[model samples]
Each structure stands twice: as C-alpha cells, then as structure tokens.
Target chain A: MSFSPLIQQLITSLRCLPGVGPKSAQRMAFHLLERDPDGALALAEALQKSVSEIGHCKLCRTLSETEICDICSATDRDSSVLCILESPIDVLAVEQTGGFNGLYFVLSGHLSPIDGIGPEDLGIDKLLERVQSSDIKELILATNPTVEGEATAHYIAAQVKDLGVKVSRIAHGVPVGGELEFVDGGTLAHALAGRRSLL
Target chain B: MSFSPLIQQLITSLRCLPGVGPKSAQRMAFHLLERDPDGALALAEALQKSVSEIGHCKLCRTLSETEICDICSATDRDSSVLCILESPIDVLAVEQTGGFNGLYFVLSGHLSPIDGIGPEDLGIDKLLERVQSSDIKELILATNPTVEGEATAHYIAAQVKDLGVKVSRIAHGVPVGGELEFVDGGTLAHALAGRRSLL
Candidate 1:
C-alpha cells in the first residue's frame, strides 16, 4: 500500500532540503520520476560534482572551487579594504549591489554561546592573521544586525583593535524602500542614534 | 561577482524541482554544500538510482523498480474491481485512506487536446485490453473533478461501455469537513443534488 522501496527512499532523501516537508518531498520525488527524468539526472550529477569539488577559499573562507576565490584573485579589486561577513551568501548579496570593490572575509557563522559556537569556530584567528599579513587599511563589519551577529562583529573588532587597521561597522538604519511607520523600534532607535550632521 | 561555476550549476539544477525559484534554489544549494554534504551526496545517489532503475509497472503503469507493482502483484487485492486514476500520486492517496483493496491503473496524465494529449497517449488501448482480458466486474474512475479529468473519465467510460463491465465515476461533492458557506457554487450544487435520503 506504500511506495516501492526506491521511491520511498527518494522521497525521504528529498526532505533534507531546508524548507521541504513530507508532502513536498513526496511531490518532488514523484515529479522527478514522472515528468522530468532528464532534469533529475542532471541535478544528481550537479549535486555530486558540487559537493565533492567545492571547498572554502583559503583567502576569504567563502565557497570556491579554487584555493582563492575570483574576487580575491582579481587584480582590479581593492585588497586594502576588507569586508567581513557571516556567511557565503552575504558575499553574493554584496557583490550583486555593483558597489564595494573591496576584498571579503566570510566568518561562516555568528557567535552563539548557547549553541557552543565560539571565536575559534568562526575562524577569527585566521581573519586576524590575514589582516596582519596583508596591507588592509580598513575593515568593515557587515554581519547581520541580529544580537549574535552584533556580538560577533564586536568581538572581531576588539581582536583587531591593536592591529593598526581602521575598523568600522556597516551603517544600521531604515531600509531604502521601508516606510517609517512600519520600521521596528530598535531600527528607528539605531537610526536616530547613528544620525549624521548634514553640511 | 557571481558564485563559482559548480555552485552556480548546482543552484540552477536545484531549480528543476517543482515550485523552487532562483532564491530557493540558491538556498538549497548552499544549505546542502554548507550544512549537509552527507545529505547532498545521499540525495544525488538516490536520484541517480531511482531515475535509472525505476520503470512503470507492466500491469498498472505505476512507477516501480520491479516489472509489476506491489498492489497489482498481491494475491489478496481484488482483481474483480479496478480503480482508474490520473497519476501515481492518486494511488498513494487512495492507499493512505485504507478504504479499498482494489487494483489501480495509472493514466499518467488526463486527456488534454489543447496540450496535444489524447486517448492513445494515455494508453487507453492497453487499458481496454486489460479490461477485456481480465475477470473485472466493475471499474471506478477516480480521476479529479476538473474539466480535463471529467472528459477523460467520460471518454474511457464510453470506450468500455460494450465490454460487459459495470463502469462508475467517483462522486463530485463538497469535502467532508468543508464549511457550507465557504464551499464553491458548483461543489455546493453537486452536494445538494447528490444528497442521500435516510428514510
């Protein structure tokens, strides 16, 4: 009365995706088996190749197939400025903006003592080493605005304080398209506290 | 400024699943790469094995690793009553209800002339052959109540009218737990028309 063994296994395996549940997994398995076998095969091959071949870039800790990512290796990028982020996806988000020609350092995750995540888990030592060794002049802490992210940024800033590099945090305020009425209290407070004097 | 080639390929490939868009695909690719490499590898293996090995059952056309599906091959299931459905997922739905022990015939898709699908494409000839050769006493068309499904059920019923087997379509009415005020007009009408008398 249940699916065949292979079908069942396929459905179970599909549930590893972030938001997929049992029903979605079942639908995905059936969709692959019935409608798009070629796509299913291609996806399988792509997953196998990506998981086995992709690794963290030695320079930035962002996902890369090579030891150094394209941004780190590019001659046109500004190595003197380093932007620190919490995850690899943040690197993509920043790059999509068409601004900020600086180098990047991915922390992989923020500090969370409850989850047992510490400075060493985020490779802060390696980031400090990179900062000390390179000619980086400015460091921008671009981690998320969450409590853990702010703590992580502050910890890294404290570590690099005596390293002679100019350290700064990314601006926190209302988003460009957001209405003031809908903005959260914490964001409004930050925006007011960090307000600049116009010339 | 984009992801590495393999990462990009994996994200693009992940979009092949139903309802997954660019952002979801990217999230899935990164999630598998960062959080669950073992799951990623396992999913790849499962997809490869399922797609390459699973084929339609010889007797029922439902996806199966073996020549015949479990339901069709079981000796306990009734061969004298058949339930015809539009897809393999319907078989799973019916089986989950635990109400009937009749065998199933999967049409893979409903008849759609606009999309160029027809009776031959749904293997109507094979279905007729099975009905004529088997000792089946009755057939229950359990296709969806949509336009195409109704047309398909009607077409199939007409084809098997002269075969001396009793043919019936599953009822169309409001769902058991649905509120009467919220139910659509067509469904409400069907519910009223099909109302039973207990006197």
Candidate 2:
C-alpha cells in the first residue's frame, strides 16, 4: 500500500530539493513529522518568511530583503575592485575568508548551452553597464572551475577588453593542505601551468 | 558580513535536520530561495499541514491523521500477526515491499540508554497492553540490527514471552546485492551464524 494522501504529497513536494529523490524525500518527511514537529514548524515559518520577503538585489543580483543587498551597499569595501561570482553562496564563501574587501556582482548561474542559459539570462548587459559607469580598475573572475564558468569568464573578459581595466581569474591550484598526489590531473595541470615566481 | 535575518534564520532552522550542518543548511536555504521558491512554499505548506493534522495511531502508535492508522484499520490485513518496528519510516519501507500482510506497532525510536531512553520512554506498556487485549499470535521484531535495536527487541520479547505468542527477529544476512568481500566483519559474522538450511 502507498502512503496517506498528506504523507504522499509531502514526500512529492520534498523531491524539489537539489539532491533529494523519492526515498530521501520519504525519509525527510517522516523525520520531520515524527522526530521534530517543532523543528518542522520552524522550518515552515522560515521558508514562508524568506520566500515572501527576499528578492534579488538590484545592483549585485544577490538575495536581499530590499532592492540593495548588504554587500552591495557597504561603504567600507573597495569600489575600484569588482569581483564577479556565479552565486550568493559563493559570496558567502568569499566573505568567510575575510580576504577580499572588493564589491561583488552575482551572476546567479553560469552559462549552459545545453540548458539554454546565456548572457541575457545572467543579466550580462546590466553587469556591463555597471562596469562602464563605475570607477572600477580591476575585475576579478571568481566563478567555479567548471567548463561553463570558464566560458562565462571568457565572454565577460572579451566584453571588457576595450574598457582598459585589469581583468584576472582566481588562481587554480591544489587546495591548501591538500597533497599533490590526490589532486585531480586537470587541477594539477592548471596549477603547474599557472605557477607564479616567488620573489 | 552575514546573510539577511530571514536567510540566516532559514539556514539555522534547516540545521535541525538529522545530518544537516552549517554548510548544508546554507546550501538548502540558498536552493529554496534561488532555484524553486514555489516548491519551497509548497514544502512549507506541507510541513504545516502534516504537523498540524498528523498524530499517533491510538492502537499501534504509528503516525496517522485519524485515531487509527491506515494499516491498522485496513480490513484485509492479518490482525493475528503484529510487526514491531523502530520508526514510522520502517513502516513505510515494509509497506512499499507489499510482502507483509500484518499490522504494525511503531516504537518511534530504539532504546538508547546513554541518551536516557528506556522501555517506558518507547511506550512499551502501551504495546504490552495492546498485545494482551488483541488476538496477536505472532510478533515480528523488525527493529534495526544495532545494539540499541537489539536491546529494544529483547525487552519486547521478554514482555510477551508468557503471552503465548511466537516472537522472532527479522533476520541477519548479507544484503541482496552486496558482495561478500565488501561486507563488514560484524555483518559477515551474523550472516555466517544465521545461515539457514536450503529446503
């Protein structure tokens, strides 16, 4: 026999998550219902509040409650150096590092020809307008190392070739503390090819 | 800088799930806000709906919208045979197979002594009361093979040893598709010890 209608609906709804399937959905639904109803209630309230109130920041494309996100509106960041990233989560990662104080532009996603995600879909025109109107001197491409990320970075770099701004991609290398033998061949090759000379 | 209040609360609340950590919570919150707001809304609705409507079955202690669960109330099931499981998810697993025709009693969790769980905590008295009042001739202990699960099954079997019911465990053996070389030592030992005679 199948689950009750409510249970079945809950399981089906949970399948919309990134890695969850039918079995995992069922597990999550039962877990919420049986183990922690109060937690489930809190999750429900959080989802509703965030979905209804949050929207894309007009300047940076990061998620925000208002037209401008905190990062985009911060006064202390370096306005001359702009870092372009694929998503808000990446912004979080960069923020956690506390290394770069540059402003950010969120692309939301990388180009995928098979999936039909192109320049217009990522609001490349808006980014170009921002770059042209601002006093930006250096542009950092901080997108992932995937094929789509490379294509997006290349497209943006070509667009800004005539703008007389320094364009750079984040260095590719074996992660800090990771052994060379365990690193993938592609990453190893990139790390070797992009080696920097130490003074 | 941190996320907006709504997003932070969402990530915090999502962390209430079993294996979810700070990173996974952030990932889930971002996925809900960015990729599928509508699906997130549906999940929120489902959580609220199920949490408010679902309650324990009065007979077998499984989750149900009504006083009696669907399995317990079904007319075609064998009322003389009762299967005891650790959680409602186990009930769903058994139901999915469509093999067992018996009713089920859900313990919700196994006895974890270090965590302060005991017989009284799992409603063992309620299970005993039902066994005494019902026509249950056999009790199948379908809890997991963990130490806590074993203790729970043993406690239940001891409670019903004098009730003129046949108490048995599910089984211990190599999983259907798992190879012998890859099987853990504990599992392989159980598989060897519980070897059956081919008819």
Candidate 3:
C-alpha cells in the first residue's frame, strides 16, 4: 500500500529540492518524521520566514531582508569599486576570500538567450544606472567563466566603457594548490594567454 | 562578511536534511529564494503538517496518520503471517515488491546495548503480546543482515519458538542478477551454507 496521505505529500514536496529524487525524498521525509521532528519544524519555520521576508537589495540586487544589503550599506566597504557577479551565492564566495573590500552588484543570472534570459531579466540596466550615477571608478566582472558568463561580461563592459569606468574581468587560471598536470585544457590555455611577467 | 541573518538561518536549517552539507545547504537556500519560493513555501507547509499529524499505527507501529495503518486494517491481507522489520521504510520496500500480503511489525531499531537501546525500547514486549493475542502462525524476520539485526532476529525467534509459531530469517546470499564472481566472501559462505538440493 502507498504511504498515508500526509507522509506521501511530505515526500513529494521534498523532491522540489535541486538534487533530491524519489528515493532521497523518501529517506529525508522518514528521517525527519522519525528521528528529528523538531528539526523538521525548525526548518519549516526557517523556510517560511526566509521565502516571505527576504527580498533583493535595492542597490546591489543581492538577496537581503532590508532595502540595502549589509555589504552595500557598511561604511567600511569601498563603494567606488564594484564587483559584478551572477548570483548572491557568488557574493558569499568572494567575501569568504577576505580579499575584496568593495561593493557588489548581483546579476541573479547570466545572459542566456536560449532560455529567454536577457539583460533586462538580469537587471543590467540597474547595474549600469548604479555605475553611472555613483562615484564608482572601477567595475570587476566576476561572473562564472562559462559561455553565457563571458558574453554577459563583454556586453556589460561595452555598456560601461563609454561611461568612463575602468572595467576588468577576474583572472582565469589554474587554482592555487593545484598541479598543472591535472588542470583542464581550457583553463590551462586561459592561464597561458593571460600570464603576466614577474619582472 | 557572512550572509544576512535570514539567509544564514535558512542555510543552517536546510542542513538538517540527511547528506546536506554547508555548500548544498547554501545552494538549496539560494535556489529556493531566487527561483522557487513557491516550492519552498509548499515544502514548509508539508513538513509542518506531516511532522505534527503523523503517528505510529496502533496495530503494526508503522508511520501513519490514522490509528490503524491501511495494511493492518485491510481484510484481504493475511493475518496469519507477519513480517518483522527495523523501520517503517522497510514496509514500503516490501510493498513495492508486491510479493507479500501480510501485516508488518516495525521495531524502529535493532537491539544495541552500548547505545542504551534494548528490547523494551524496541517494543519487543508489544510485539510478543500482538503475536500471542492474534492468529499469527508464522513470522519472517526481514531486518538488515548486519550483526545487530542477526542478534535481534535470533532473540525474537527464541522468544516465540515455544509459542507454537514458525519463525524464519530472510536468506543472505548473492542477489539475483548479480555475478557470483563479484559477490563478497561472507555472502558466498552464507549462500553455500544455506544451499538446498533439488530432488
């Protein structure tokens, strides 16, 4: 016999997660029901609160509860230099490096014409407006090094080039602590083409 | 800098699901917030409803929203044969096979004294009472083939052998369609030991 209605519903709804399939959904549903009901309740509350309350930052378009994100509104960060990324999670990745102290602009996604995604869909106009209206001197393109990301970066560079803002793309190379022998061909080629002289 | 408080809480809460780590949790959180907020809300409601309403079946102790599970209450199912398992998930596995039409008894866990789990904790007394009070003629032990499961099955068999009920453990051997050369040594031994001759 099939599971009771509520248990079946729980398993079905859990399949909406990115990587969860029927088997994983069943495991997760039973795990929550039998071993950790409190955790299930807490996760439910967290999902409800975050989905209903979180919104995009007005200045950066990053996920935020307030009008402006903490990184954008912080006084210690440099607003003159902006790092443009494909999604809010990328913002966290750059922040974790403890290197960038500048403001950020999240595009939410890259240019994907086949999927009907355009510059307007990703708020490119808003990004251009922010750069033109503010005292920003440099714009860093930190989108993923994929076809769509490269196209999106180039398009944005052309848009802001005439506006007198210095535009730069993040370097593509073999990752630190990685051996050259194991590096992918495309990345190695990019590293060779973009190498700088130590002298 | 860390994510905004709400985003951070959502990521942390998502980690409560099995096999979800920090990276997967973050990806799931952003995926829900950006692309599928409606799915997130639905999942939250399902989790809340299932965790609060689902309880153990009165007869079989499998997870059920009703007092008696469908399998236990069905008139067509055989009451003379029972399958003893370690968890509710096993019931679903057996049902999917469509080979057995008997009731089930869920132990929730096998005996483990070091973890402070014993027969009483697993409701072994209740299992005995049900077998004695009902017309059950045979019991099939379908717990995992681990050490603890073997011990649990043997203990239950000893308890019920004197009550005039036939008791048996599921066989452990090379699975159907699996190559004999690829089978493990332990399973090969079991297969040879349990081999039956065809007259």
A35-132 per-residue lDDT for model 1 (tens digits): 99999999999999999999999999999999988998999988899999999999999999988999999997999999999999999999999998
Question: What TM-score does chain A of model 2 get?
Answer: 0.95
How many Å off is the CA of A118 in candidate 3?
1.1
> Using alpha carbons, what is the TM-score of model 3?
0.97
By TM-score, the candidates rank as 1, 3, 2
Q: How high is the lDDT of residue A73 in model 3?
A: 85
DockQ (Cα-based) for each candidate: 0.90, 0.71, 0.89
lDDT of 1 by residue, B79-175 (tens): 9999999999999999999998999999979999999999999988899999999899999999999999999999999999999999999988889
Please give the range of 10 consecutive residues that has the lowest summed lDDT in model 3 chain B. Answer: B1-10
Q: Clash pairs of candidate 1?
A: none
Please, what are the lDDT tens digits per residue for candidate 2 over residues B1-199? Answer: 6989889999999887766788878888899999999999999999899999988999888888888988888898899999999998888789888899999998969998899988888988898998999899999999998998998999999889999999999988899999999999999999999998899
Q: Write the per-residue lDDT of candidate 2 for residues A1-199, one digit (tens) a residue.
A: 6778888888898787777778778888888988889999999999999999999999989999989988878898899998999999999899999999999899969988899888989988998999899899999999888999999999999999999899999999989999998999999999999988998
- Candidate 2 interface RMSD value: 1.2
- lDDT tens digits, residue span B1-199, model 3: 7888999999999999999999999999999999999999999999999988999999889999999988988999899999999999999999999999988999978999899998999989999999999999999999889999999999899899889999989988889999999999999999999998999
Each model's lDDT comes to 0.94, 0.90, 0.94
The deviation in Å at residue B138 for candidate 3 is 0.1
Estimate candidate 3's alpha-carbon lDDT, on a 0 to 1 scale.
0.94
